[model samples]
Structure formats: structure tokens, C-alpha cells
Target chain A: MQNLNKPNFKFTPLQIVQISVTVFVILLGLNLWTFYAEPLSKVLSPYWNDNLIDILVLIPAVGAAVAGTLLTRQFEKGETPYHIWQAFTIGLWFWVAGEIGGMVNDALYWDTIYPDFSLVDMFWLLGYFFLGLSLYYQLRLVYGAKSRSRRRIYLGLVAIALLVSAGLTHLAIKAGLGEGYAWIILFVTVLYPVFDLTEGATAIWISFLFGRGQWSRPWWGLILFALADSVNTFYWLGGYGFIPVAAQTVLNFISVIAYPASYMVAGLALLSNYFILRYGENSGLLKVAIKSEINKP
Target chain B: MKYFFRQIEDIPLDHSPVSAEVYFRGENATGLIEKQFNADRVAALLFISGTPGMAYLIEASQSKSISLAEFSSFADGVSHTRAINLPDVAGRLMLLALESKVNDKFTITTEEAWDKKISRWKQEQRSGLVEVKSKNLHGFIFFWQGELQKLDLIFSTPQGFVSGFPKLNALDDSAWDVTTYVHSASAQAYQCTVLRQGAMYWCHKILVRYQEMVGQKLLKMMDRELNRQMQPWHWNINLNENDMLDTHFFPYLMDEAHAYRALFMAMGAQMNFVIGNNLTQRLLSETFEQIRPDERAALQSQRLIPAAFSE
Candidate 1:
């Protein structure tokens, strides 16, 4: 039987370091430019937190587009798995939708935009759907044809996540928010986090199955992304007074850092995965140890 | 026409001689013959005639015990069905007359003569005498570790060469006694006997020829689908004289077109036919469903049949 599980290659240690440093430098430079440049900040002041949009949404969205395009081209040439290319394409569309929604929100300048259900929420919901789909495809590729057992486990976990998120939403509703903002709060505070939690948990599960030795770099990157999303969720709930504000200042700083960090890490993960597929064999990073036991002479 | 029979209870076990031989003369005699001794035992031989496609010879063999009377009866029955005319029945009538005269020396001479005739017969079959049909469909069967790994089908149409492969599970755990019938509207009918042992299913012998045009088309299709250059005509296993004694060879039969249609119909009925593309799947399903129920059932049965049908 063919060993389909083996990758073509992997990144070298130096390449890994170079990629990490490049991402860090880019993010740090963008943050410094946004915060310290007086002339730019004054000019963009009219555009509803242009700095936040640039850092949290635009940069990562572009990265996703690039990664998605590369994956699609590879798929057309029969160089990548069908599911992987499909997942990336969906991710690209998700980002495009979100970017459009962000622009719309900025133009309107609605006061209730942050904690309210609006057209932006619809885009975000769609984004969640695509993200879930991407994760599902990745899991399917890993599991292969004899996937009945693994699929049951995955579905079970998804059920648990739904239950947990539903319970959290119920508690938040009981805490007594105004009726006018209840639906909005339910969507933003409850639904968004539920999607994030489920997607993150599933990604973490897939990464775990990939094993620590073979794909630890991408695994760590995924963990960072998942952690950032979780932190952002907790921060949103805290702001809505769904949790006790014991360490409010510290939580606020963490949330601020995490929101942008999640997007950056996800972009990096996409880039790294593409590199692994393209250059792992040449770099000697992606070696498939033949299962001698399965194939005995 | 003379017929002879010799039975040895304690035959010298060094090397088993050719089991059976046949020689024929006529217009329709320029074809192959396949016969099944029982449900699990099958024998096939090609016999294209020499010099103006007349006077053909055929040989059949088995490793197990067989009734000579039953064998003679089968040949008689096939000759009747096929409307073959035998000039004189003196040889067949002499079986009882020569039973007492059959000694080790006579058995050795008969075996040697049959072997020599079979060698010449194989050479004649390989000669460029058989007609090659243009724009005909072709099929290739691949085996790995004695198991049927894949079956590739390529059809030559005015539109282009259309090709597809059935899913892996299509031949999974196939019975050893399964016989794949190959026939088309414009081709002589042939049969491939499948043998299974343990988890592996394979053909002990095959007589289909490979077409270069079909191979080229298959290569192109594989390249397009996989984005890799593949030589569809290349056989991983050796098909030389040494290998022929043990391993099966993909027979290159003459004048057979659309042979894959019969094989696909037989296999599709027996196993799940998962085509790589959906359009091909939809197109082929109707044709696959048209296979006769008895034909389908013959290939599907796990238990061996009392008699195996061969053409």
C-alpha cells in the first residue's frame, strides 16, 4: 500500500527561525508605525480606528488570500490534497467577507457595533462556518478512508462543545442584560465564542493526532492561534460583565494583545504549511519512516 | 483424425508433461479454446492455425487428478456445440484398444510430442496473423503481491479516449473460482479464470494482448489526472519464458475489441464500482446494470460452482 500520510518535506531549523522572526518583525513594525507615527495617526483619525483594522484584520486577510491562492494553484496542478486546497479557499472567502463587513461598520460608525448584531455579525457567522469546514477537511485527510471511529469521536467532541457553549449562553442571559441588547449580546458574547471554542478545540485535537515529533512547529502555531482566540473570547465576556472583574486591567491588556495575535499566528500557520508541502523533501525535514512491520518481505 | 488417452496412477513426478492437446483444420478453427475441469480448475490455450489460417493445435493441462472419459466427453460436447466437423473417429475409438499397450515409454513419447506441438502452437499464436481492430477499447489488470490491485479501462471513441478505474474494494476478497468473461460485438469471446488464496486474488493465466494506441491513451490520461508521467504499458513483473512457468502473463489476444466492456460489467456487478469522476460513473451505470442476472450471479457466488463455463 502507498504511504499517503508522509509529507513531501519539512522546514529546516534555520528556515523555521527565519519564518518566525520575519512574522514577529513585521507585526512589531506595523504596531510601532501605527502607535508612534504622529502624522499617520492624525490623518487616519477620521476613519474609525484605522490602526486596529490594519493590525487585526487587513494584514492577516492578505496573508490568507496569498496562502489560499497558492494552495488552489497547487490543487489545480495535482500537487496538494483536495480537502486542503478547498479549506484554504474557504478561509480566503471568509476573510474577504469579514474585511467587507469591517469596512461597512467603519463607514456607518454605529455606536452599538461592537456588542450588537449587525451585517458584520452575519459575515462573522459565515467566517465561522468556513473555519469549521476547513478544520473538518483537514481532519478528514489525516484520518483517511477508514475514518468511522475517528469521525464518531470528532462528532462527540463537537456535541460536547455545543452543550458547553449553550450552557454558558444561558448563564449570561440570566445575569440580566437589557432586553434591547439581549440578542446582540447573545450573538457577540455567546455565538462567536462558541464557534471559536469549537474550531479551536478541533484544531488542537487534529494537531495532537499529528504527533509532537513530526509537525510540532505547525502544532505550536495552531495552539498559539487557538489560545489567542480563547483569550479574546474571555475578554469579550468580561467586558459584558458576564465574569467577575477581579484582574480587569491585566485581562484588558491580554485581550488587546490576543485579538491581533490570533490573526497573525493563523497567517503564519498557513504560510508554514505551504512551505512544508513545497520544500520539506529537499530540506530533509519531511522524511517518511517506512512502516517495516506493515510491509514485511 | 486420431485420438489417444493414457492414464498413469504412479506417474514420474519429476516434471509434469503437457496435460492435453488438440489439432484442428478449417475456417472457424483459427481461435482460442478455454475449458474448466471443475469449479476450481480451469485451462485455456490459444490455437491460431498455420499457413493460410488452417490446421490449428491446442493443449490443456491440470495438476490434479482428472477423468479421461469425462475430458473426452467435454471435448465431444464442445465440438458439437461449436459445429466442428471431425473427419475420422478412429483415434478416439482406439482409447480402449490401446489401454493395455500404454507403457512408460509410450507415455514419455506422447508427453514429448505434445510438448513439441504446444511450443509450435504458442509460436503460431504469437505470429502476426491475428487481425488488429482499430479504435477498439482495451483493459489492463494490475496485480500486487499476488492480489488484484487495480483494473484500468480505456475506450476509444470519436470524442477521445475515455478512461476510468473502479475503486479498490471492487475486487476485495474476490473468490478464487471467479471467471471473468470477455466478449464484444466484434470480437472472439475469451475468459480469465481468477484464483484466490488467503487474502490475495490473482489470475493464473491471461491471454489478452496490449494495444500501443490504448497504452498511449492511458498514459496521457494518467499524466493529466496525476500530473505525472506514467508508462501504462510497463509491467512490473517479468513476463519472460522463465517467469511464465510460475507467474501469470497478460495475454495479448488477437482481434478483440471492447473486451473491457464485458469485464467491467462482470466486476461492477460483483463489487462496488467507484469511478474517479462522477460523469463517467453516471454514464457507465446504465451499461453495468444491463449485465444478465445469471452472469452477475456466476461471478458473485462465494461457493464454487459444480461446473465452470469457459469460451
Candidate 2:
């Protein structure tokens, strides 16, 4: 076949896809194995599930750092691409720090969970700030030509974030969610949904902007993260009897698979971004990433 | 037509008004014109001496709005016949200097040859004029205190700024000129490079931001990297001092826009490596954007920022 004559580099994309899929399967399988498989479910329940979450989340976080290092070399340091990758790198590691902290904290208190305002939240929150910076630069690069539209996009995303976060918070409070917790804990507890929804909106927008390309998967990966966090928030809001029977079953399903799935997707997203930029750039996608050819309005 | 230049009778040693003195004057120099180039061979090869030099062919035909061009730029669409009659007191007050004292001892053809010669000259601490008398290639280059100064090597002599340096491939000349020994002292050859007025603010901003971002030690390392990349391209822009950019002189480059782009590209790269790229790009965009619209327009007009700063 003529395909056989192609250079070895061509297969890298295939290899990436295969390896990522394998990782996703293993992680997701480990998280879900307790439910479907007979005796293995009992064995893996708390210990293996915790381990899976750590591995899944850390993979993407570390991947972001490594990707940042590699991709930084490819671009001129003071360029848009360089800034975007660096921000992402720093931001992702912040999440990793939080994850590591949470893991350690959990290990120390095997029997009990930390309070609502754990130190881990601090790292995760800071991660959002840097991650926001990366997105700022990333959007700056594309929207330079006729940035009025870009301004509108910003306004629109912000409005959506505000509306959704307000609605969710109100609903969360009304459902007797914070009745027992301290008011301070309640304030922090509701912040996750706000952040997650904002990021979800942005990721969905970015996904649409990029279309169904190799790069879109990473945004989708973040979407999973947002989805998982939202699910966690929903469950906290006295979700019992709050939903239809079928919908409640779906939420339960989401609860089981969502976090692990989010970590796997998000981590792989970072690694994939690196691969796509470095080795999978033959598709002319990076040009789109750094410079937008969208017609001026 | 034939033109012969008669050397001026020696002026008193104290009389050093380079603009007024006619060093070498010729007559009927048009007939000696070589066909390979455009522009009429002017009646005189006016041999004037100073730091970085400028040459003008003030045709007798166009005495009205007389213009002076840099020595390296050739005037096009004119005939040798027009240059037969030279105009005096026209384009004369303007100052363009050449290295008066030629040290033609080290004649070089290729750039590779020139590199070795320059190194030898540096080792020997040689100082004199390096004359380029190859057919139509007439540059009065000089060395000062073991260094062939940037003025003699750049295109900034005519205008205040130079775009880029000339590469060996860009030479387009067959034989290199001789290095004639004239001045042994370094006093005369110390012509400071002139930079564009508005380019000052931006260059200062860039260098300062870079310094602040990368720190002094790494900044020196970046300077070394810049020179390393620029050397192979036949440039001698020494960025040892950051002050040079803010003052009247920025280490100038001479020649095409593409060559200038390479210098900027290299500089940008060094900045990125030393500092995070966001700061680098942000500094560039922010500085460029913050300047007055007129200043920005002036810089863009001069193409002072290379396409490497395209983003």
C-alpha cells in the first residue's frame, strides 16, 4: 500500500490516539470495575478509586508542564504561542499541587474528610487564575484583527457565567444544602460550580471555534472536568428526591464515572495538545491556534 | 569622455572643514563609466574624509532640488553624459564622511577572507582606512584601535539609521579592496552611529524591559548570542551597552529589510529564551502600541521594526 511508503512520523498521531485511548480505558475501567465486575468491585472500592483519581488527574497536570517545556522551545519566547503554553503549564501544575495536597490530606485522615475550606481549594482556585491568563493570551492571538467581536465574546461568556452561577447557587441553597455547614463553608462550597460552569462555557465555546479537529478534544476534556464538578455540586444540594427516578439514576451514574473520567480526559488533553502541536501540526491546525483567519466583521 | 582627478593642494593642517574642502576633483569622468551598473559616472570622485561617509552625484542638469544619496546606494535611470558637468555648492553643506585614512595593507575579496584579516588586524591593534576601490564599489572603510568601527561597516553614514548589514553573497563585486594605512590614531574614526528619532523610545523600552526581565548577567549572555548570530551574516552591531539605544546612537545595521528582520528575529528569540515569552511579546506589543500614533507611523514608515515583530 502507498501508506507503507509514508515516513515514520505519520504514524505518531495514530500511536498517540491508541495510547491515549488505552490510558482512558484503563483509568475508567479501574473506576467502574467495582460496579460491573463481581469480587473485584469490593477489592477496588475506596483505595483503588482514590488511587485512580490521583493518577488520572496528575497525568494531565504533569503533561501540561512537560508540554509547556517542549512547545516553548518551538516558538519565539515573546510570542503569543509561547505565552499561551506557559500560562497553561503554570496553571495545570497548580491543579497538580492541589491534587497532591488533597491526596496527602486524605492519606493522613483515612477515616474522615477535611472541612469545606481545605487548603487544597486554594491551589485549585489559583490554578483557575493562571488558566484564565492562558486563555486570555490564547484569545488575544486570534482576535487581534477586529477585536470588537472578541470583546462581545468576552461579554457574552461573562454574562452566561453570571447567569448560570447565580441560578445554580440559588438552587443549591434552596435545596437545604448549607443548613448544617458553616456559612463560610457554604460560600466556598458553591464556588466550585461557578468556576466549573464558567470554564465549561468557555471550553464549549473553544470546542466550537476549533470544530471537530484533533485539538478540540482537549476542550472537550475540560468540559468533562466542568461536568464532573457540576455533578459534585448537584449531589451536595440534597439531590436525594430532587430529580425524577430515571434522571436520578443518570446522576448516580455520573457521580460514579464523572471524576475519574474528568481526570483522565483532562490529563490526556494536556498531553494531546503537546503532541498535536509538536508532531501533529501537519494538519495546519497550529496556524489556526496562533492566528485566526476568520473573516473580519 | 575622460575624467582625471587632480589632488587638491594641501590645505593648512588647522583647516579641517570637511564640507568646504574638495579633496580630489576630476573632469569628464563620465566616459570612464562601467556598463555593469546604472547611474552616470560623475565627473569627480570627491575624496572627502570623515567617520561614516556619504556620496552624492549632484548632476549639473538638476541643480534645483539637489539630493544626496548614501555612498552604497546607486542612482538609477540617468546617463553618464549628465554626470559630465558637476555642480558645486549643491548638496555640499550636508555632511557624509568616509574613513579618510585607508590601511590598504590587508586586501581582501571574500568575506571569509575578511574575517581572518579583521582578526589579524585586531590582534595587531591596527588602525587605518580599508579602501574599497573595486569597480564601482568605492567605500572608505577604517579601523580604530583594533576594531573596524560600525560606521565604516554600516549603511547609517548617509541616513541616521541602517536597515541591515551586507552579506558576502550580497557583495556582487569580484575583487575586494585594499587596506591602506593613513591614520594611525583612533581619534578621527570615532563617528557615533545615528538612530531614528522615534526608534529611540521603542528600542529603549525593548532593551530595558529585556534587561529587567532577564537580569544583567543573562542580558550580557543575550548580547553575546545576538552577536554570534549576527557575525555570520557580516554584521558588526555591538549591543554591549543598553544606553546606546536611548542616546543618539543605536548600534546600526546596514542593507536590506530581510537582513534587518534576521537581527530582530534573533533578538526576539534571545529574549524569549531568557524570559518567558508572554513578557517578551507583551513588552513588544505594549510598547509598540503605547507610542504616539505619529511616532508609530514614523517607525512603520521607516520600517524601523522588522517584520519579525510582525505579530
Candidate 3:
């Protein structure tokens, strides 16, 4: 992660435009993956099983995600608009993390004789998890403002998020105790929303603090939130695919309804803050600020 | 004229001109208006712009046969013909400051013949001797002697030389040529380049204009207005002082929505101009120039730009 306090760094229109193109490419890749997953799997699986292929795909995906994360950091460092290597790596990691998470779930639940718990598979998941963790922490390091209070606030937030996510996962798994662990399913269900909200908030805070004139964090946070919610909306609208209509509607209510509403709430909070700054100075304070500025060389 | 005054009772129509005066009491309202008019009469317009307590003079005239136009040639310059008049008193005053260097007579054509009429009428045959008359005016006309090389609005109102030519050309109200008209309208051309460099530049030319007009009156008014409209959000500002530092805004999302809503509400009563998308997009695009790309995409996808701000 790059330090944000460099005087020479500035976000350019071209950079924003390039970043947008990269985002578009990522979205396109995801769409293609969703549409051709099975057909692509059939062709590739001739040499490997479906599960192995899934893990194999993670190699490039996780790499892309890491690279993309690094690219973001580099951009902040005023290196260039984007580094192709970084973008590709970050993109790769994003895909790998999801795949690895799923594979871990499969290994835990569906394996017979405990599947002897393949070291390679386990290592891969752990690797991807750490990669994601690193990316997140690096993001904070590069973009987060350096203030003691802010650091404390962010740390507190992360702690709360992890605790809440873990607790919810525990409850879900406990409910299905005797029927089998099913911990992965519980973890995912609990993980998505908690991380989404936290990531969104963190993104905004980082942009406010370090981006200064850049839009990287805010754009990503908003687009990601919008995309995530949109997926739920589309899925629900498609009759929840295989899920029961009632359950699907409930999921839709939380993701489609509550998620967007929360973003709006956050946006409103920022606006209120701006209003206060623009309008809440006392006469004496205002005079002092003006006089002080005038008194400056 | 009587008919025009009657229309004043219903002034500021969404589509056509409304006959009433508009008042801008909010802190930034004057600033906003000054940016638009570049004149000292923002407060003057405030007496006319709609308010809860202010009765629509046109509305009052509506029941009768009186019109606002009757007063334009006779009373104050509040009539329709003058409503559209360029080089108005305030505008002319600023023009004097610029014209102080002008000595020779040159042809000055306006896009609108009316502007030409007003300009010619106000032309000083002798330096400092331009006798512009009408029962509606209340100031002495001063002309700076020099060759009329250019139109300058910096010292004048927006209607003065800055917009004088453009207003005339825009009589057809078709395309507004920035080069031939007002140069200040294109102030955001470099903003895109600035953003590309990761730097943000905020130009508050209008805010500066407002500060010059009524001291801190508008700022104080805005604070009070916020208090009234948005309770629970006690904006801590001393509204009694004439200091810019005392000015602040509690820019919450709701406030953004409200500000937009108020702007639209006012604009909607005027005319629906196709700004593409929705009213919000139109307003932001026109005022801010650079719209957040995501926001633009979102609105375009949603078809949300209102057609009022284009006008």
C-alpha cells in the first residue's frame, strides 16, 4: 500500500477513465463466467475433475484480485493511472477468493472418509483468505487517514464486524448441529452482508480521508454495493431460481431493500456533515478564520 | 401593459415569463442569482422572487385588467419588455466602468433587436452625457470615453456587455455561443483536466459575487431558512454578522434532496427545458459541469434527468 500524503500524486481524468474500463472488463468477465461456467467446465474437466478445475481457476482469479488491489495502491502512490499486472492480479484474486471459499465448504461437508483433507486444497483456501485479508489491510494502510481517533474507530468497527459475523455463523451452525456441521453455509450467509456494509463504510471513509481529489474508493464502494444488491434484485425477480418463493422474497427484502436504503442513509450522513461545515460557523469564529487568513503572508 | 402587470400576479411561470418579482433571501440564493445575472440587483430581485409572505403581484393583478408591462415603460423596470431588457440600469453602470476607455462610435449589434434598441438608447452621444430616460429608471448614466473595442461584464451586470451580445443573439433562444456571448459560462472546461490529475478545483465565482452584493445578509438568511426548514439540525452560525466565515452548510443527503427539490419546484413553475434525464441531473450538470460518471450512468439507466433545467 502506498502512503497517501505524497504531494505530487493527483488523480487525472484519464486515470478515472482507465479505471472505469478495468471495472467494465471485470464485470464482463464475471458475466461470462456466470453464463458459461458449465460449458467451460466440461471442456476443461477432460484433464481435471470439476472440483479441481474450480480450485485451478482460483489461481488466476486470486492473483488478479491481489494485483488489482496493488494497482489501487500504486495509483494512490502517484505511480501511474494503472498497472496492468496489478489490475489482472486483483481481478484474479477476486474470483479465487470466492471459489476457494466454496471449495473449503465442499471439503468440510461433502467429503467421505474426511477426504483425507488434501493439503494442497487446504493450503489454497488459506492462501486466498490471507490474500484477501492482506488486500483489505493494505487498502486501509494506503487510503485511510492517519489519525489516532480514526484508527481506533476503524479498529473498533472491524472488531465488531468480525464478532457479529462469527456469532451469526455460530448460531446458524448450531441450529443444524446434529444434522452435520454445515458451518460453511452458515458462514457465507452471515459473512456476505456484514462484510458488504463494512466494506462500503470503510471505502467511503478512506476516500474522504486519503483520496482527496480521487474517486477510486467511493466509486468502487458504490458500484460494488449497487452490483451486489442488483444481483439479489435480479435473482429475486427471476423467481429466486430454485429457492422457494417465500424464502427468496425474504432474502430480496434484506439485500434489495435494506441494502440500498442503508447506502442512502450513509450518503445523507455525509451531506449533513457538509451542510454543517458550510453553514455552522459562529460570527466570532468566522471573523477569526478570516482575519487569520488575511493576516497570513 | 395592464395585461403584463396582471400576469405579474402569476410571475415566473414554468414555461413562459411570470410577471412577479423574485426574491432570493437564502445565503446562497443571492450568490446563485449573482452568478446568473452578475448584477447588484440580486437583492432587488429578492423582493420579486416568490416567497410565502410575498403576494404574487401578478396574482393580485390577475383579477383586474392591469398588466405588469404597463409599469415597465412608466414605473420601475419590472415590465416584460424590460424584463427581457439587456444593458439595464445596473448593467449599464458596470458598462460605464468598462466604457470609460471607449471613445469612438462602432456598430454594436444584438441578437435581439430589443437589446439593440436599449443599447442605442443608452449610448452616450457625448462622454458622460448619455441621457437614458424612462419613468422606470432611477440612476445617472456615466459613459467612459474610448473606442468600443469589447463588451466587459466584470464591472457590469451579466446583462451588461458580458451577456449583452449573447442575449441579443439568443433572442431566437437557439444556440448560445460562448465566444460571441458570455465567456464566463464555460468556466468548467478545465475542470475535467484538473480531475484527471487527481486534484479538485472548486470555483465559487458566484459565491464571490454574492459576497459583494449584500454583505453577509444572504448567508444569515440561509442559516435562518435552514433552521426553519430543517429542524433538529441546529446549524451553529451567528446570522447577525457580515462575515463569510460565519457561512456554513449542513450538507446532508436529505438537504441535497431538499435543495434540489426547491430548485426544481421553482424551475418547474417556469418552463420545462430538456436538460436530458431528470431535473436533478440537469441541475447538477449545468451547475457542476462534471457529473459523477457513476451517477450519470445510474440516472441514464433510470431515465431520471428532468427536462426543466435545460431552459
Candidate 4:
């Protein structure tokens, strides 16, 4: 009887155009960042590529990811605009940090290590990281959730530890403390991504299996971030040669289909489960018993 | 003519049609139009109440009358046994009709599919009359039109609300007739009734109170029928008030009278209209009161009791 099909509001022509342009700019910026900035930093100083970029970008990215998790918690409470803003902020900060790391790596680290590195190259690298960071964070913050103080504290601590570790790793390398200790600091920086990815995945799996399905909002955001990171990594390094590229292209095609295909599968599962849930119950106790059985191992 | 039923299913998808039709007339114009224009093309497909995914079209043409036993079997075949709760069969049928029309060509736009479905079923079915029947978990007699037999009236005693329908083949029956033929299989009988009186009363009240925007004529017809049947009778009083009454009532003076059989006829009529099937010929055939009680009893004797329960 009620018209559930109608959306709350229709987008105007100008709004549609704006969104299209924003999306296009974001995409172009990302390609430039990946193709130019990332490679240039590595070319300038191979040693700094592995460690410095992780410090500047990786830690902040982890913080942004944690912020996404916090925002999801807010969303469950029915906070809409606040949730969206928080998610955006988390994504923004993480991306900004990552870009700064890239810029500092190219401008300061490369210039110091290699006398041939020019300021023009440094500026280009800075612009590249800035553009890429903006694009990634913009995408991440789409779902917007409320910010949590505890998460903020945790992210700050992580940032402080990363900066201190980066400085210590640089000092130790200059003193010839050897690659073993530098690798230890490198491992610390890597922990940011590793921990965020693991937490996000765990939250998603747990919510899906144990918690109400509605509670999986944060998990979805994290999953998206993890997926994007993985894809970007593969794309940036040009990891695939001609043979791998062909294989991956096919895989990507399947993956694209796979995304929408999952929805159809989910719909069927829901319909079957609906009948079972709606009719099978006799007494209230029987309903409880049935639910328990469904939840069983 | 399309007859609308309420609260057909517990869960409805974001986009799904919800209506059914019963054609008593020999023609299947509605069925033809639906097949020609599928409804799902414009809208995303949603599940039918009991069926797996919405299959859409169900034709209850006069060419093939679905008996109570067959109705139960067809319903069971579609619904998974795990979920035993039955949705309103009439409502489910309408939902099926809506789904059947879904296709790329038929539903080019939302209004094209939805408004068109509503218009065709309602407009076409109103011109004719059809007789249909439905059932419940426990045995009781209810109908969209007609009278209840005495024995059935007593057996299906309602704690609060009650309704009845005459058998499709037995419009001539009198409830007061004292004979074994009333209850016997050879007499006019029915397996179940369609609209439960209690539920219908509630539905009527809600519609009248909430959906005042619907047609006034329909509201008046529903109200007049409700008031007529709801009268408390300490003495025998002919409840018929309209000059051209399609339904008749007979009080059972003896225990042998069969109200259940009469109730089935009325339910069948309701089902007929609900599915957008024509029923004018059946309603106009020999006046409602002209059918003798003996003729009604004779019709009951011909009905076959299934080897097992209808469920």
C-alpha cells in the first residue's frame, strides 16, 4: 500500500554533474599518484622507499581504518550525519598522513641521499602523494559514522610511536646499526596496516556469524578499505607481467560479476530462511529452541 | 472482476505486486493480457509468499475448477513443509498474478506495471460474478457471499465473530430442512470457507476507518452486508433486506441441516471475484432463494471426501 520504491529526494542536474566531475578528478589523481609519485620515491632512494613511506603513510592509514571502525559503532546507534562526518575525518587524516610521508620521502629523504634529486622532482612527488591521499580518503569516508574518543587516543598513540620509531630507525641506520634493527622499526610501521586489516576482517566475520546482520556496517567499510589497499598494491608495483596481466584481467572480470552475484545468492538464502523462521514456530519456547538450533555449531 | 484482500503476507519485498482474480466467465481475457505483458521487467523480482521466487500468474478459469482437495495439494506442493503456517490463499494468488506480468517489455516503467495491473484486474472482474472457496487450519465456514447450513453453523460456532457461504452447486438449500442428506457426502458440502468472519470483521473495520479514500460504493456494500449478518436473532427473521439479494439465509429447525455446505458456496464466490475472474453468470443463475433444500442436499452427496485430510 505504501510506496517504498520512491527515493527521499531526486538529484538535480547540477548535483549530478558535480558528482561526476568529482569522481573523474579523484580517479585521475589516483592514477597519477600510483604511476608517478610512488615509483619516483623508490628511484630516488631504494632504502628509504621501504621504511620512510611506511612511517609517513602506513601508520596514518591504520589510524584512519580504526576511525572507520569507531564510526560504525556510532552508526549502530542511529547517528547519520555524525557517522558520515566521522568516517570522512578518519579517512581524511589517514590519507593526509600517507601523502605527507610520500612527500617527505621524495623531497627530504631523496634530496639528502642523492645530490642529483631536484626540487622540481620533489614538488611533483608531493603533488602526486597529495592527490592520491585525497582520493583514497575520500572514497573511504563515504559511509560516515560518529567519532569515538577512545579510538582517537589509540590512533594518536600509534602516530606518536610511528614518528618516534621512524626517527630512531633513521638515526640507527646513520650510525650503521645494521639492517636487522632497521627492519625491526620497519616491522613496527607494517603492524599498523596488518593490525587494521585483521581487526576489520575479524569484526566483519564475527558480526556475520554471531551478531545481528544489521551490525555489520563497520565491517563492510573495513572490508572495502582492505580490498582497495590490496588492489592498489598490486596495481602500483605493476606486479603482473603480460601473462599475469591477462590472467588477472580475467579474474577482475569475474570479481566484478562476483560482487553483484553475491547479492542474488544472499537474496535466495534470505527467502528460504524467512519461511523457516516465520512458520516453524509453535509455542514461544519452540521459537527460542529453533533459534538456538540455527545458531548451533 | 478483481477482489482485493488485506494483509496477504507477513513480509513484502520493496517492490512486489499484491492482487488476485477469479473468472467465472468462460473467457480468459485477463490471463491473456498478463501473459502478453509480463510485470517483472520494470521492477526487481521479489519472493511470492509460499512459492520459491514469485512465479506471478495463476489462472482460475471456469474451464478448470480447483476443488478443495486439489487446492490443498497445489498449495502444499508450492510451500516447503518446514514452514507450516499458511498465508491467505487468495492474497497469495494475487501476488502470483502480479509477479507473472513482470518482464522487460511489460514493465517498462513502475506505473506502467503497477497501475495497469490494478486497473485491468479490478475493471474486468467487476463486470461478472465467480464462485470460489478457501479453508482454515481448523474446519469452519466463511464466504464472500451466500448462506451457511444449520449443522455447519452449529459446529463452527464462533466465540466472537462468524460468517458463512453457500455451496457453489447448492444455492437452493434451506437450513431448516431435517434430513441426513444435509450432512451426507451426497448432499451439498464443502471442505472449508474462505474469509474467517472474525478476521473479516476486523479487516472491514480497519479499511472503513483507515482507507476512507477507497470507493464509497464498495464501503457501503461491505457495511450493509456486515450489518445484515451481524443481527442477533432470538426468533427466526429473514435477514435479506436488498431487493436483489445474491445471498440467502435459512435457519436450521433440526440437527440435520448443513451450514458448512452453504458456507462453502459463498466463499467460492468471494474467491472467484478476488482472482479477477468473471462471475456474473453464476450469480444471475436461478435466483439465490429459488434453489430448493433437497437440490442442495443432492449436490452435497456428489462431493468426494479425500482418502486423507485436505491439509
Q: Which predicted model would earn the best lDDT?
A: 2
Q: Residue-wise lDDT of candidate 2 within A1-297, one digit each (tens)?
A: 211122256456546656776876775665466544534336655755566556655664565456556545544566455677677667777887988888888787768866667778888888776766666665555455247888678767756765665675577578876677665565556666777877777777656544444334545656777777777777766575578888977876776676666556655655555444344333222332223221121
lDDT (10s digit) by residue, model 1, range B216-297: 2221221222111111322122222111111222222221112222222222221111111221232233222343443333
TM-score of each: 0.43, 0.43, 0.28, 0.23
Q: How well is candidate 1 docked (DockQ)?
A: 0.03
Specify the highest-DockQ model's number: 2
What lDDT does the true structure give each of the candidates? 0.37, 0.49, 0.33, 0.30
Model 4 Cα lDDT, one tens digit per residue, B1-311: 21121112212222112222112112211111111112221111222222322222234320122333333233322311111112223222322223222111121123344345435545543211121212211122221223332222311111211234323223321221111111212211121211122212323332332112112222233233333332332111121222112121221112112332222232222212211112212222212223344333333342311111011
Q: Per-residue alpha-carbon lDDT of model 3 for A244-290, expressed as tens digits? A: 88886566445533333322332222222222222333211122122
Question: Scoring only chain A, what TM-score does candidate 3 earn?
Answer: 0.41
lDDT of 2 by residue, B1-311 (tens): 22211111222323222222222232211111111123323422332211222333333212111123332233353233211111121111111222233323545678888788779889997754454434333344445557764434422112222324444445365665554545322322222212232344465566665554333434454555455555554332446635322111111223323443454556665554333344456667766776656556655654655344533
Q: List TM-score (chain A only) for every prediction.
A: 0.69, 0.72, 0.41, 0.34
Q: How do all the candidates rank in terms of TM-score, highest first? A: 2, 1, 3, 4
Error of 1 at B226 (Å): 19
Candidate that beats the other on DockQ, 3 or 4, i.e. the better one: 3
Residue A105 CA error for candidate 2 (Å)? 3.3
**Candidate 3 stretches greater than 4 Å from native:** A1-147, A177-193, A204-297, B1-311
DockQ, every prediction: 0.03, 0.04, 0.03, 0.00
